[model samples]
Target: MSQSTAKAAAADASASAALRARSEVARLISYIVIGSGAAFLSLRASTLPTSRWEPLGAGSFPELVFGVLAVLCLTAAVRAVIDIRKAGGANRLGTSFAKWLVARRYSFALFGLLVVYLALLPLGGFSLTTFVFLLIAQLMIAGISKKTLIQSLIAAMIFSVGLNMLFAEVFNVFLPRGVLFAG
Candidate 1:
């Protein structure tokens, strides 16, 4: 066999392997449809008790929003299934176990970041915690760049201070201030 032919065969094998690693489209479609139906039913069946603020008695807006989301999810699921069928196994599309594995690989780091940030929040206050979290997040996701590292740290400080003031003063939403301000 010629070198070109061998390279072509190798490429085809790799493509096939990648396709096999992907999730089944039909299963994804079924799950999405069932999940949306359940969400729709739950929202529709939810009862809101009488409250002075709600003249029509709450649960009205939530149910409407949920119904809309259900319709959207259902439509998306149907379209995905149809597209996959049209592709005739040429395209591996849908959220499957393989995709979940890939997503988890990327997202697990976020869980750790959240844990550290929350753990430090009470001890370091919002500014310090925000700075550390933002820096770590930026570095981890994008890799360390001197400019990006400095910018993210500064931006975190600005955002945390501004948002903290806005919530505490303007909205009267008390955020944890730690023991720094107590003394």
Candidate 2:
């Protein structure tokens, strides 16, 4: 083949590979989210008590919600599988997952921060926990710098304290005060 033809062919191959990688990643994410969410919802719905006293019963809402969610998830999973097949199957799923992980390391780190924030919420209280979570998350996402640090601190304070005050005073809703700070 000529040099120009060879270059064009290589470019086409590269584009095709990228497309396939993206398709595989989409399929994997869809499968994980929809499948897991459906299962979780189903379990949660099952745990809700069925009572004859109430017209619809306590489990009615949860059961309905879970049923709908399961149907939607099934549809999405089927679609994802079809897309994966069209993109040449999951032969490169591992490679695609690795590349996606590397590319989204920061996102994964932020998710970890969120998990920590949730775990500490009851212990540290809403205001304090939210402030710390926001500060750390903002710094990690926006990078550390004098100006960004100041901005993050201000934003965290405004969001945590300001929102807490609003909820407590205006909305008449009290957030957790934690064992240490509870009065």
Q: Which candidate has the highest TM-score of all?
A: 2
Per-residue C-alpha lDDT of model 1 across residues 73-133, encoded as one tens digit per residue: 7776676666556546535454445565675775888888999899889978886677778
lDDT of 2 at 37: 82
Against the reference, the lDDT scores of all candidates come to: 0.70, 0.83
lDDT of 2 by residue, 126-170 (tens): 999999999999999899999999999999999999999999999
Candidate 1 Cα deviation (angstroms), residue 57 = 25
Error of 2 at 112 (Å): 1.5
Instruction: Candidate 2: count the clashes.
Output: 0
